[model samples]
Target: MDEVSPEETPSQKVPPWLFRAILTGAVALGGLYVLGWLIAELKMLIVIVLVSFFLSFALEPAVNRMERLGIRRGVGTGIMFLALLAAVGLFLWAIGTVLADQIGDFADDAPGYINDIEDWLEDTFDIEVDAQGLLDEFQEGGAVANLATRLADNLINLGATVLQVLFQILTIALFTFYLVAEGPKLRRNICSLLPAERQRQVLSIWNLAIDKTGGYIYSRLILAVISFLAHWLVFWLVGAPFPVPMAMWVGLISQFVPVIGTYIAGALPVIIGLLDQPSTGLAMLIAIVVYQQVENYLLQPKVTAHTMEIHVTVAFGSVIVGSLLLGAVGAVLALPAAATIQAFLASYLERHEVVQELEDAEAAQHPEREPLGDRLRQMLDRVFTPK
Candidate 1:
């Protein structure tokens, strides 16, 4: 081969340090990409673990109370678990029994109800309709019938679903038990990992997380109970069928989902009412709307103010984003997730020297100006200024 000229020898390549830096960056990027994929793939498991941990945290106060009252830690945990199981079992049994009875009653009266509905439709719209044909189409060989058949055919698949749920529950319980048992030790260990100067800050964040989460759980429980009782009373007064079961479902579902819970809870009763009488359905709808408004404006604000202090817009956005990302579990977790983010941001802003300096400067500049625009400018200035 011909000898390469000095100018064409590629300058003996770049330095090793620069090459190593490039390699390191590429490796880091690849690792991050892989980590992202893993996180997405394992999202469900991550959610389950997080939910279990938070629930355990919420239950710790009760366990501690029991321990203080002379109960052994294991026994207290067992008792708490038993109490939870019993409550859940009883609730499910009650709902199932009520649903079965209602469904049977609906079946028995369906023909008359269909006839009434058809007649009402004809009278209201002056259009004749084939009620029997519709009912028959839904009975055993129509669209609805096909769907039912498909669901029945897939009953075997339900076994897998059940197993998955069971596995998740067991995992959660195991994790929760350990969390409750070793909560103090875990906290101590976590704190011990921090430098002496940073430990206080870390401890403060931990305490804030615990307090906010615990308060949120307790307040939500109380609110759910109140909502259930309120709705139960309304249904009882209105003479709606299966008021107790419906109310209980409203409570439980609402506890899981925040703003939208009332609407969902109202839907069942309204549907049932429509199958009974149009006037009944209308009344149920009105009651639901009124109750939801009251709860949103009055009850929710009072209960949540002391807990998370998240804005309504933040709450709604969080729910929508979370549901889009991870479905029902995410929706249920949206508030806590938002609250946690808020806590972190709040803490960071408070502790950041630049932020503090800007805040001080703004406070010094505007001692009494409360005009909306002035306040907005001041806030922007504080947010953007350097230390």
Candidate 2:
């Protein structure tokens, strides 16, 4: 017989389990991929629903009170919604009027401002600046024409974007209205599907969520109103133009937007005051700094301690994480979300009293009596030493 080549020999039979294992893995991977794709597609809808849920939680207490007073839930929700709309409309109207007037005034005074700037430069630095020449060069470069052309080209896209935004707003409104109006029914339906123990637990969690979310929002609103009044008084005293709108801007931004909001809110009034009169600007700046300090030390702690009960560091970290995950909307919702989670965890999780030694170590002592390094070392020893 001819010598058989290695290639011609029959291959060993594949293991049945190995084949099944590989097939199962492939199916599992495909399923995960499809799930991820679906989640990505529905991300916006999920966000909208979350927003609606939070709005409902914030409005539930008010609606409940109205219901107890013999008003229908639907009617109460409608009334609340209309009041909110009216407040927002008034704010927009005030801001718009101020902005329109300012823009017109600025346009008319443009040449005078340019001349003043040129004179200041020449007097202070001996630099002869040609403001008109720069403007002429800019116009000559056809930048204005190009900008106009781009705006014209993108007009249709802008309109489409506006329409899309309006649709989303409508969707949010409808969902929020239903959630608030039918809240009791919704809770009952959810509880019906659960066992008695689970139903109790779920209802407890739902009530906790409403308390935390509503408390957070109402506290912020109170702080915002206080801030607005404080700033408004300062602006009026300093003779700042558009004081009401500017104060409102400061209050809303500083309360809602974290981190950089105070600076941004303070900037407009300061700039406008400087343009009007340097003394006014200086006074406004001083007032802003003073008010910020007061708010930080006095106002915020007192208000938030009762309502939010969230640590500053935890709140800041939550905002950062939320912004990273979902942008501005995430940041706005983070505080209430964090408060709810914190309240739930606090209620559910067990706690133990601190040992005497640990409590004593944590207690503040005079640095003169105990050196800082020694105290730290003692604390570390106490923590790491064996029982």
Candidate 3:
């Protein structure tokens, strides 16, 4: 061995206790890694169960209604499930028809549309666009053509995705059927594991979650319908093709998606109108603005506050975090999750009655405090910190 120099050695030896702690931490970290790997492997299964949870809560009311009308609970659950399936099938058919029509129309008029766009550019901006030449270049085995070819090849992957979706749907349906049919029994079994007092709390949270989830889902549907009607009327008045489906798309997207959903939903129709004829997109834009004003100022806050009972800031923040976590699914789930937690906290958590009570208590030891305006401003500043 080489001779040890003073500077070459560690300043101090690690203690036996610290060594044991480090070893324990390393083992705990490895265990966490294994657990995470297992979770990833079961991601789809977990998602199906969670999705079933949401559906069970959302549909409990309808099933109960059917049961109240002299139907058995199991029978009522089955009927509701069938009705849900039918509705989904109908929606898919409508979307497929719209897609077919749009694709066919676009394919047929693509050349004329390109030429018209070029003409518009030349007339409006006094700048000639070689759109026709560009189109020709794209069709002649250039990079754009290769990209298109690749996209066409990738279309086959849709079949695999469809199969996976079908499997998930069947799994969720099976789970939901059992959940709705045996919800009371399931709750009882779950509550049996807890103390009597804790059971009451669990059941209370369960019922409240169901109410909030059902109300939220129904409210979104009603809002979607209203948006669809506005979109359809505006588009039909302007003689847009496939107005109904396009409007349906706008309504659903705007209602379900958070924050920028309205703009995204409105953009599609405007683009279609702009492509179809001049000034039509402007009329569509006007309709979107008017409807949004009516919805935001009048409809949304009332319906949402009635059901959601969440702060506006919290709602926005939840949507953003949810979207960041799980894309579209998180966005849809975010509001209900936040509402559930808010309700639970309101029910159980004790809140301070006074503003700055801690500061006030600490200030009692001091001789004098700041002026009221300064104190108020300071409190407000702390509450509303800048991003």
- Cα lDDT tens digits, model 3, 1-387, are 889999998779667799889999999999999999998899778778877888999889888888889999999998888888897786678768976776667655766878877999889999888786767644557555576677778887977888989999999999988988999999999999999999999999998889888888888888899888888888899887678878887888898778878888888778777766758878888888988999988988778877766788998999999888767777888888888888888889898766698788877878586899999999999999986
Per-residue lDDT of 90 in model 2: 86
Ranking by lDDT: 2, 3, 1
- Provide the overall lDDT of each model, using Cα atoms, as 2-decimal numbers: 0.80, 0.87, 0.84
lDDT per residue, candidate 2, 113-134, as tens digits?
Answer: 8788999999999999988864
**Model 3: how large is the Cα RMSD against the reference?**
9.8
TM-score of each: 0.79, 0.85, 0.78
Pairs with steric clashes in candidate 1: none
Best by TM-score: 2
| Structure candidate 2, residue pairs in collision | none
Tens-digit lDDT track for model 1 on 174-242? 888888877778878988988987888877766666666677788888887987898789878877777
User: Which runs in model 2 stand beyond 4 Å of their true positions?
Assistant: 1-24, 137-153, 364-387
| Residue 344 of model 2, lDDT score | 90
Residue 307 shift from truth in candidate 3, angstroms: 1.6
What's the count of clashing pairs in each model shown? 0, 0, 0
After TM-score superposition, what is the CA distance of residue 260 in candidate 1 from its true location, in Å?
Answer: 2.2
Q: Cα-based RMSD of the predictions, in order?
A: 9.4, 8.3, 9.8
* Position 210, candidate 1: lDDT: 68
